[model samples]
Target: MQEFAFELALCAHLERPDRVVGRQLGAAVHGRRVADVCLVEPGPEFDRRAAVTPHTIPPLAIESDAGPGTARPVAEAFDCHPDRARAVAERAVELGFFEREREGASTAVRQTVRYPEQWFDSLVGIENKPDLDRPGDLRDQLRIDASLGLFDEVVLATETYVTGAHLNRLPDAVGVWRFDPETGEREVVREPEPLATDGPGIELLDREPGRAEVRPVTAAEKRRQRRRIAERAYGKGWRTYELPDCERCAPSDAEPADLADARLPWCAWTDGLVRPVADCGPTCPGYEPVDGGDSDGDAEGVPPSEGPEAVRARRSAWEPDPAGVDRRQAGLDRFL
Candidate 1:
């Protein structure tokens, strides 16, 4: 597939990505699904990446080395369509810069969302989603953002309370956007919000004809999708995913194996919580566990091996909460 200029900018914003949520408000300037807007945690890294190589640069850089103080200049030098380039600038003003990280092997979209929102402020691109233009049964855009491999579900609502005030604009629309698990298409329905209130930006009194169509999930469908979503918790939760590895896929210029012969699951590379322990080589600072134990359970007991059963284990090797290992403010500035 061809790459979007936003690809790099997106990478910059989602370097060590965790979760992403996008909502569609209007037509995307690029004639693509406008997620309307997206947000990345640790939003600073994304900013640095985009600043280094803003996609708006003309004559786009060809993997060349950047000269000194050249970050801003690159963005100014792109030779492309004025409207297209202008769209980048406009988005910068409307949606603040993103924070991404250096690229790694394997992956296209770190992750994708319900719809890439259209930030152009013009309704010209506001046609129904390709998968959502149906009259009305049920429809939802169920996609797994491939970024950090943590966020997995986006519940599509015809109009929802998205970050930038979605559902604020829209009238005479008659149908709810839903996902049909069996057929996997957006559906339209004639019901309003399940609760007694009008959701977020929707006004209760303005129940005009065809104004409030909602395709709520049936109890059975809800259960099935819910289970499906739950099983896919990694892209949506703290669980990690297994990375495929094979002979050619493995490193070619790799170092010989250690006598210990222990390797953490590749998923540990991005798993937020128990990550430190995964890199537990003698040379790594995270090499030693907080308490030198097998489980983060208690202060006493020779627990089972965390990674190696033959190796001795102790209760002292774990942090009180395994999740605290990657904490941003544990104040281990100079020391772990």
Candidate 2:
């Protein structure tokens, strides 16, 4: 619960108009390592990428042979099985990344626009350990992140006071930040050194007894994984939680003064930020169910709050909707 609050507060603090921030994203290539938060700094072609779609353009479609010039049969363009290829192509078309055409009996697809290679500048992976004293798997997680070099930089954010011993235990490449979730004040304890993103790196897979399993990730694979991360982040912003249908839920009052407008799930009864799924419902002592039929009654369920999509569109670089490119007419010549 503390970690949840800390993560949300940190995300609110990091969010701005210049970059995009997402939470609980998969950061590893071969292994299953979920980053606490991912900060995506915009590259030179960010505007072009954002104009393509508000949602993620299917990575498979981006990597496939489909181009803007010619419409290729889905089966021919995508290397995957016919069904999977068609499904991915369909999703791409839905997202305005691909334009579909009837090629005789088969379906052909082409990119609405070329995939922007330099859409995102750098990815900063942050691991939130609000309480460093209870540092379960903190060392191992940081080690995997630093060794893999998938992110441009990795940092550990904590509320715990740093000591020489704590710094000594961490990898020199990993940066440290002391963040107070209550006040939204962050102090950088150590600056992170950039990782070798251009070259191959090691990925710690598993460990048992004295032996540890590892894999060597190639540069090409890392590039694909990085793109996947960026797309996922762009599609899934940090405001992933929904407010519970409870009158006591006060999102505006839950966050710090800086983040008062963040619209997090804060229970007035608990007087703290809460995970609506876990901490809410009738089971909770303070859960006052919103009376739907209360036209004049004092009972109020969840207040009419601005949606997360609106908040994200207002606060971040992510576009809620874009005038996407639709090249379906270009493929019409094939019918002629």
Using lDDT, give the best candidate's number: 2
Residues 1-336 of candidate 1 have per-residue lDDT tens digits of 001212211212222233322223211111122332233232223323222221222111211122222122223333556455444433332222221112243111101111111211111111232232332322211111111011221223332212222332222132234322212234443232222111122112212456843233233432232222222221122112221221111111111221112222222232211223333345443333234333222112323233322111111111111211111223423432
Please give the clash total of every predicted structure, in order: 56, 1
What TM-score, over all chains together, does every model reach?
A: 0.19, 0.93
Off by over 4 Å in 1: 1-32, 36-39, 43-68, 71-76, 82-152, 157-336
> How does candidate 2 fare on TM-score?
0.93
lDDT tens string, model 2, 14-62?
A: 9999999999999988999999999999999999999988887888999
Ten contiguous residues with the weakest lDDT in model 2? 293-302
RMSD of 1: 22.0
Q: How displaced is residue 13 in candidate 2, in Å?
A: 0.7
